[model samples]
Target: MPSSRPRCSAGSSSWSTAAATPTSSARIAVSIERSRPEAVAALALDAYGLSARERQIAALLLAGLSTQDIAARLYLSPHTVRDHVKTVFAKTGVRSRPALTAALRPI
Candidate 1:
C-alpha cells in the first residue's frame, strides 16, 4: 500500500500532517496561541463562583452543547437545563452563548 500523504515538496504539503515531518517550534507556538482562548475561557468560568450544577452546565455551554444534550448527558430534564443556562447567563452577565463566550474571552 502507498502512503496517502503527499511528498513534502516546497509548494505542496502532505494531505495529513500526521504523516509529515516534524513541525517547527514556530508551528508549535502558533498551536499554543490558538489553544489559549479555551484555557482563558475555562479560567474565567472558574472565577464566576457558579454552583456545582451551574458550573457543569456552563462548562457544557462553553463546549457548545445544547440544552437537550446537556440534559441527556447529566440526566436532567431539558427544562431544568434551560433554567440552569439562564441562571448561568445571568450570573455571567451575558444574554447568549456567543455573548457568554465573548464575556469569558481574554482581554
Candidate 2:
C-alpha cells in the first residue's frame, strides 16, 4: 500500500518559522504561514537528550533567532549560547540550524 501521508512539493513543508516583523505585537501573532509550534520542535529535540537550556536554545533557533538574540533573551553570553548550540548539534547529529529544524519536524 502507498503511504497515507500527503505528498508535498519538493522543498515544501506544512510549517515554517515566523518571519521578523516591525512591532512586538506582530512578532507575537501567528500567521498561517508560520503555524508550526515550538513545543512540537522541543519534543523532537527532547529525543536527543538535550538539557533544558539546550532545548530552549533549539526552540529559539527553530524560531529563527540568532545566537546574539538568544544570548540577550536568556541573559547569557553569545559564546555560551554557541557552546550549547555546538553540544546540541553534536548530540542531534546536525551541523546547522536549518538542518536541525528539518531533523526535528513534528512526527
Candidate 3:
C-alpha cells in the first residue's frame, strides 16, 4: 500500500510538505515538540533589555540572518539594521553575532 505519511523537505528554515505517510507524520510531530522550547526562548528577548526593534533584529540575527537580510525583511535600510545591531551589542555587552547568540541562549 502507498504510504499516507507526510514527506517533508528541508526548506530555507523550515520543512516543506511533499507527500504523506505515518512515519513522516511522527517525525514532524517530534520536530515541532523539540522546537517548542527554543521558540519560547526566542520570545523571551525582553529579558535581555532589548527594545522592540532591537528585539526583532536580534531574533533575526539569532536565526542566522545577515544585517542585509534582516533589513530586507523589516523593510528598513541596512544602515538602520546595523545601528540596531550595534545597540544590541552595547546593551548585551557582546561584540559579535556568535557571542550575542551565546549570551542569549537559554542556560
Candidate 4:
C-alpha cells in the first residue's frame, strides 16, 4: 500500500512563521477592546451563571487573554483571576477552559 502523507519541506518554517503572525480575523477575535460588550454580558447571563465580575473575567478568557492579562486589565491579581475561573468552572460544570470553549463555540 502507498502512503498518502506529504513530506515537510525545509522551507515550511518561513511559511509557518508568516502565517503565525496575527491577522485581521485573529485581531478581531482577540480584540479585548472591540468584542461586543453586550454579547459578553449576555453570555454570562445565559451560559455560566457568573457574577458581573466573573462574567467580565470569562469574557477576557474567552477572548484568549491569559490570567496575567486579565488581572492587569481588570486591576486584579492573577490569584483572583484564577479564583474567578474556578467559580466559573463550578457554575458552568466544566472542568477546564477547553470545555468552556466547546460550550461557547455554538454561540
Q: Where in model 4 is the C-alpha error above 4 Å?
A: 1-41, 44-47
lDDT measured at residue 49 in model 1 versus the true structure, 0 to 100: 73
List RMSD in Å for every model shown.
11.5, 12.0, 10.0, 15.5
- Window of ten residues with lowest summed lDDT in model 3: 28-37
Tell me the TM-score of each prediction against the true structure. 0.61, 0.63, 0.60, 0.58
Local accuracy of candidate 1 as per-residue lDDT tens digits, 1-107: 22233222122221112232334553321111123445445556767878889888987887899888999999999999999999999888999999987676542
| Model 2 lDDT tens row, 22-72 | 454544433334444554465567778999999889888888999999999
* Clash counts for the predictions, in order: 0, 0, 8, 0
> What is each predicted model's overall lDDT from 0 to 1?
0.68, 0.73, 0.70, 0.63
Candidate 1 weakest ten by summed lDDT: 7-16
Which candidate number would show the highest lDDT if scored against the true structure? 2
Q: Candidate 2, which segments miss by more than 4 Å at Cα?
A: 1-37
Better of 1 and 2 by TM-score: 2
Off by over 4 Å in 1: 1-36
- Which residue runs of candidate 3 sit more than 4 Å off their true CA positions? 1-40
Q: Compared with the true structure, what per-residue lDDT tens digits does model 4 show for residues 1-107? A: 22222222234221111112345564422212222434434544455567889778777777789999999999998999999999987887889888876565434
- Point out the worst 10-residue segment of candidate 4 by lDDT: 12-21
